[model samples]
Target chain A: MSQIDEQLRTELQRQGVWVTSMQDLYNWGRKNSIWPLQFGLACCAIEMIATAASRYDIARFGGEVFRPSPRQADLMIVAGTVTKKMAPQIVRLFNQMADPKYVIAMGACAISGGPFKQGYNVLKGIDRYIPVDVYIPGCPPRPEALLHAFMELQRKIDEQKLTGADKAEFLKPDQPSEFPVPRFGRHDLEPRANPNVFQPPVLER
Target chain B: MSATIETLEAMERPPVSMASRLQGELLEVSMGPQHPSTHGVFRMNVALEGEIVRKLKPVFGYLHRNHEKIGENTSYLGSMPYTDRLDYFCSMTNNWAYALSVEKLAGIEVPERAEYLRVILAELTRLQNHASLLGFLLSDMGAWGTPLMYAFREREKILDLFESLAGSRMMCDYMRFGGCRVDPSDEWLAQAKQIAERFPKFLDEFEDLILGNEIVIGRTQNVGKLSAELAVNAGITGPMLRACGVNYDIRKVDGYGFYPRFKFRIPLGEHGDTYDRLMMRALEMRESVQILKQAFAQVQPGPVMNPKAKIRAFRPPVGEAYGHIEAPKGELGFYLISDGSPNPYRYRVRPPSFINLTILEDMCLGHTVADVMVILGSVDIVMGEVDR
Candidate 1:
């Protein structure tokens, strides 16, 4: 897509690294088996559970196994408000996991602290301590939104061809930050002009 | 008198031994605070003499976050989503209880259509929860994911219906105090109607798969048996009470919402054991399906939300009330104190999981460790509700 990206790809290929054109492979793998650690703190955790149940069916995307130990997990889907008291435990969990870990800030509270940002006990943003791959922006995102975030994460992972080195990029302290809050609804705090529904108008055939 | 009492004590202590003095050689072991099947982060210090439990003392507060304190700070509207966090399994029931309480305090009237919609959603929520919970119980029994997958398939349909109406599937936050936040379009209603029609077939399929299985029956029946008197004393309601042969469904006795309008039989089981609990839930799901059918037929197209109620920065008058719903687990009640402000003065959740847990030791005293999990599973304690 870009000249530098092409050059990088060719350079990597020249170095005897196998280049697979199936760009969605990473996404496919991530999508099928999202082994989440069973770590929940507050209200948002219920939403996380709801996501796992019959209706949202997180199992469809292959994240059904809610492992208790941090070592057995692939994605750390942080589901509730992270308090200062619990910060070290979270850091420890993050540290314990094997390489190629992805963190999904599952609710508004986790993403820039949501409504609890003003509170003294709440952490400002989880990114302050650990790097976040995706931010699901909602007071508490529904299971569907979480599934969407997972799909999006898969796409990003596949497109980048994120191997060990790309994972290392995130490990560096001075690396550029890319915590874009995934947009699912209107950005405006106020209700939009089309209050009847949130869909763009369908044009006539 | 003191000398006589000492003489009597000396007369009674003829065959004393160190082993008998040490609590009949009962083995004391802690089962939880980390065990998988206690539901939440709950610890039970159990003293057992072989397979029979001598005593059990429950240890809680590990998952406590002072939910009431947080509710005091959140506004009436803000607390709606917070309610969804409780009983994370059946969020609709949680939302309804909160809305009902606030509405009662504010004296806001919900429209008939809205009431019908609420009933339909609540019943659907009940059906989905029971199905998923049964699967969870089976998993606890070592059946693993087969049943859970089946339950999830049906649950997906219900959630899709919720998604079509509300923007979110699980934490719907769809029900407001006066009425619903959004109306179901014709398409959504049709989907619900379809689900209602086909649900029985799915249940039939489920029955074929697991209900009649000899293994399930042997594992569940006559295990963790509780008498009707004990169940009532424990304040258990819904399917648990029904399992104990009490016909007291809150929907029947304390008629609220559109439950009064619907005609359905409350199913009761003879034994209040794990098997009966499962059977009661299964039957309750059938009843919910019927209620859905009736609700769908009677539902009239109109405004879902009450047009007259001004909900902007919702503020309720100063009052206190307890609102309870016959949730899938049991009676989920919300106790709210509003001091003429947007936010509640004090809010407490009568969490069914926490309340039903009062009799865990009673249920597990004579049962094996494996049966303890099965019984806990039948109680259907969601950690969110238990912890909150």
Candidate 2:
């Protein structure tokens, strides 16, 4: 099917007709009902809960169904400090989640270990293991920040192409659904970071 | 009819060999690290005889980020923000506990107005902590979301108060060694007074909704019963200790902060069961409101921070001091050993949630698997504090 012209589509809609593509319809359904995996690692989890509660009411966006099980979830809000001890389990949980899953690293800690970055047991960032789609920066970002991240995720989902060279990451058969779960090594997480998922820039001085 | 009678007789006579085979075999079940009801990354290893928990061992260190070690490495002032994440629910109390220890170590005196602000903030923290805890406990018992939403609705009001005064909702790093970071304006004080006055009405509504409900009573009453002797022996403090009819509140005992000036009663419970523990928090929230009212009324205009206290490069003299407070959960104490350095030589946190878990197994042993969640919820262990 050819792309509908904006003017023509508006004219048609005025004349009691509507125009939409299969991709648009699919993305519309997927974007609105993104079910987050109900998992919390630390303080950010409280803010995440506040976002879901009455005042913030995340259900307004149809993303309030926080599934306790990974299989039922489409979004993983890694909402707090990801310690080295919990990193393996978090990765395993990410692997357990079905295809077409998105991750929102919802705090400074989840993004780069935040204030506890200097701690021996803290994970540098969750992106070292599983790929994160959105990163919210705060010790524990306010609920409004989380809501903004949710909307940004929705926008990303809305823009996902069904069939094209620049399609969604999950759409590509070559893209791996499961990443390697890190192990607790002598001093740190084994293989400190995943080469496939995380690529840190090297400095030459 | 004869065949039916024979089958009934067979059913009455349990299979002797089968019973013998199953008698000594116990099933071990690990309940967390990712469980929604564990209230964080808390885990329990349970050895079960059928459905009853024969043995329960709580597994820790899932969320441990080496907080104490980090405190030791960081400067005295640098660690204030870190303390906010300790309980996460009651950051004000955590701040007070840490600041109290640092002050004792350095022989610093808190300003008069700062004491009033601290009292008010701490009480507000207690109100929200206990209120939200009940909601969480109920959620754990399977009445999910509605009670939690109601609790958070009220908690948001308190959080908004914190945010306006300190500029952060949850992580309010508003306390310093000798005083609070920000002084509330007169308008802010008026708003706080309003919230304090309105809190009891919400509590009344909350209690009316859940207190007399048969399901709540059935699930919590007589479940996870901790004896008074065992409670004291295990060093259980805070509402958990008070729930066992113990009158050992750190506020009353230590008489630190301007609590002696405030007229409030510690609500004690007769039975140390899950129900009593739940009620203990509710009653304590009421007491907190009373304290808030008294503090707000007595708060006078004065400098919030002490003039002599330095923030940037705070180096205390060589000494050690342990300062504790009646945190919403229990006795939140901070121990500091300073060696005339900006950073403390030793920094240790006496986390109530960690010590309170000593009796977790004892309370959960005879209870069913489902009861374990309720008991754990009543105990209210935040993983951040417990694992830290």
**Chain A superposition TM-score per model:** 0.67, 0.97
**Runs with alpha carbons beyond 4 Å of true place in candidate 2:** B1-22
lDDT of 1 by residue, A1-205 (tens): 1223666778888999755444345545655776887766655665676677656777877788988777788778877766554454565677776555788988887777666565545565666666778899986786678888878776665565444455445456565333222212343212222222124358999
Clash pairs detected, candidate 2: none
In the order shown, the candidates' DockQ scores are 0.13, 0.86
* Candidate with the greatest lDDT versus the true structure: 2
Candidate 1's C-alpha runs over 4 A off are: A1-76, A79-105, A109-135, A138-205, B1-57, B313-315
TM-score of chain B of each: 0.92, 0.94
lDDT of 1 at B43: 65
What TM-score quantifies how close candidate 1 is to the native fold?
A: 0.76
